[model samples]
Target: MQNRQQSEIVRDILTVCNGSGTTITNVMFHAYISHAQARGYLGELIDKGLIENDIFDSRQYRSTPKGLKYLAGLETMSELLAIETRRIAKSGANIC
Candidate 1:
């Protein structure tokens, strides 16, 4: 598999936890990150108010509204970038 950036990993984690929430194992598997990495990113995301652990069940983590908004914005940006790239390629313009 190809390597992913931290932001991409965060996005994957959010996507994996978007609905009813999931276990840390699920996040790790889906996000393709190690346990240590997941823990660190989860901590940062929680501090940023992007994701929250279930109060009733600590093992469960879910994406908050802010997280969803961030995911949407990121997706939009990716789409826009893809469109620009395709345009550039079609025009035979060198990006550099």
Candidate 2:
């Protein structure tokens, strides 16, 4: 797994792409992440063979099988955390 920031950026991009094909500009703007950071994240994902670029549309990117696996893992973790939070709430445990 990558560092938190990189993982988060990749996850955000994947989510955006899964919903609707996104341009680099939209990813940077909507995700509230820096342009450099977004570009860096994309580059890393591409290098890792986790994403592929659409040459017909230079800005278009799509997640590969590896990327999907990573996203699924992240989603699983998120769901687990949500479930744990609910359990804690039900137990009257103060999270803060």
Candidate 3:
């Protein structure tokens, strides 16, 4: 799979939880990606076992263990980013 932007990857993680069920199309809409790109990205995520597509209900997808791990990592990264931003602000870096 090609390297995707962090926002796209993060959005893919969240897309599975949408109440309407998880399809590549739904994920694309959630992630604000074009339909074609969503299909390719969803295929890569499935192949990596980070996501599992429901065999009984093709439109549904769920996070796998690997996907949960990835989400945790992303959360940690987000926390770190927030901390750094706060530190810079406190230092009067004028980021705003």
> Tens digit of lDDT per residue, candidate 1, span 4-60?
567678888899989999999999998888999999999999999999999999999
Cα lDDT, model 2, residue 40: 85
Candidates 2 and 3, the one with greater TM-score: 2
Q: What is candidate 1's local distance difference test score?
A: 0.84
lDDT of 3 at 92: 77
Candidate 2 stretches greater than 4 Å from native: 1-5, 83-96
TM-score of each: 0.82, 0.70, 0.65
Each model's RMSD to truth, in Å? 6.2, 6.5, 6.9
lDDT of 3 by residue, 25-68 (tens): 66766566677776777677788777777768977777777877
**Model 3 residue 66 distance off true place after TM-score fit, in angstroms:** 1.4
Order of quality (lDDT) = 1, 2, 3
Task: List model 2 lDDT by residue over 45-74, tens digit each.
Answer: 789887778768867877777888889997
* Per-residue lDDT of 59 in model 1: 95
Best candidate (score: lDDT): 1
Please tell me which predicted candidate would have the highest TM-score against the true structure. Answer: 1
**Candidate 3, position 38, lDDT:** 67
Which residue pairs in candidate 1 have backbone atoms (N, alpha carbon, C) closer than 3 angstroms, thus clashing? none
